[model samples]
Target: MKKSKRKLAAIAAGTVAAPLVAIIPATSAWAHGYVSAPMSRQAQCAAGVVQCGGVKYEPQSVEGPKGQRTCSGGSRFTELNDDSKGWKVTDVGQTMTVTWTFTARHRTTNYEYYVGGRKIADISGNNQQPPQTISHQVNFGGLSGHQKVLAIWNIADTGNAFYACIDVNVK
Candidate 1:
């Protein structure tokens, strides 16, 4: 019985260790929208909406000041900023899903979700909860090719936005 118990323990350890060992050190898995750090790393897309990492945004980042979009869509007053840490790309396929958690002030907060720079959805509310989790999944005609997804958060009290964009190459 003792020998059998030892064998079982060894088998369990191998089960856990095998997966860890097989993971390539440099392999990149899809993560929600905080880009890979060191600040210089970035992904680009054509002139439209794009999803990258865990967040989505309209237009490519290469445009810099010109590419940024307002959370409410079609405005030049203020730009997308992340007070609640904005949305992140959770998964991508025929339908792509993006999610993020954030805290809001005592005022009304407006969150807008977008695909390819077009406003797809939005939620607005006042003084209810913090660390609110917002998520969206869009079916792009069943993942025929590349699709762009973006989420931008706008707090009424503060005119800044937390925004991220990603380019999903659907398979």
Candidate 2:
């Protein structure tokens, strides 16, 4: 009887501890998006483009503060911003298709792409859902050699955004 009771207690503790053991204290309601194509930093972690800790399971959950051009999602995810992440650079032409994979389809305002800290393209999301993947055609006309492009999916109702940095070798 004591062994059974101890097993039950352990099960109960594990059930409670599961939520607390996350790298980020994120609830399902808040995590919304990540760029899948061009393989954003977080997506790279998911795709094994680089070695990342917990982000491999939740690539779409990079919920950092607004106006920051980082892929870390800020704070606990700051390792994503490290310059030596060994991220694989994708090769592309003047235009590339960026696909965003969402876990929770939040109302979205728009999608923006930046290269060398300059806004290159601004596309519309306008609060959509399901269907899983969102794709945008972005032009990298003025960029050459190697560049890191910042892709953002802006949440409509909140001041949050899903940030991704994609390394590319422009052809």
Candidate 3:
């Protein structure tokens, strides 16, 4: 009788843990988007252009609280914040089209672009879900030389945002 009781408890624990294990991967899937063109750091990781950690698996998952300045959005992908990581820099004109690829679109507040910690452009999201792919024309405003452009997607209904850093050489 005692052995049977122990076996039943173990079975009950496994049953309770099974669903939780199944839900773990689903949480990571909640990540929505990333800059594809001009190939953001995460995009490089996903494309095997750069060797990386877990962010290579989910390039769109570099999400955290809004109003962040770092490339990782204060997430666990600190690798994104490493400027020495040998990120690829794309060459572009003074005015270039930046594109984003979405895995799961969310209602958006606005899209913002920054250079040297200064906001360069702001495109209204109109609080709507964007298409699977969207592009914006951003003028570097005569800013030249190597620059890191920080792109942020603010979700309208959530306090979180997705982040991508695009390294570029303006010529």
Q: Against the unseen true structure, what C-alpha lDDT does each candidate score?
A: 0.42, 0.81, 0.94
Winning candidate number (TM-score): 3
Candidate 2 structure quality by residue, lDDT tens digits, 136-160: 8999877788888989888876788
Compose the digit string of candidate 1's lDDT tens values, residues 20-122. Answer: 8778532222111221211111222211222333222422122122135633233321233322333332345676555544333223365455665676666
Order the numbered candidates by lDDT, best leading: 3, 2, 1
- Better model by TM-score, 1 or 3? 3
Q: lDDT, candidate 2, residue 108?
A: 77
lDDT of 2 at 169: 93
Candidate 3: residue 109 lDDT (0-100) = 95
Model 3, residue pairs in steric clash? none
> Candidate 2's error at 112, in angstroms?
0.7
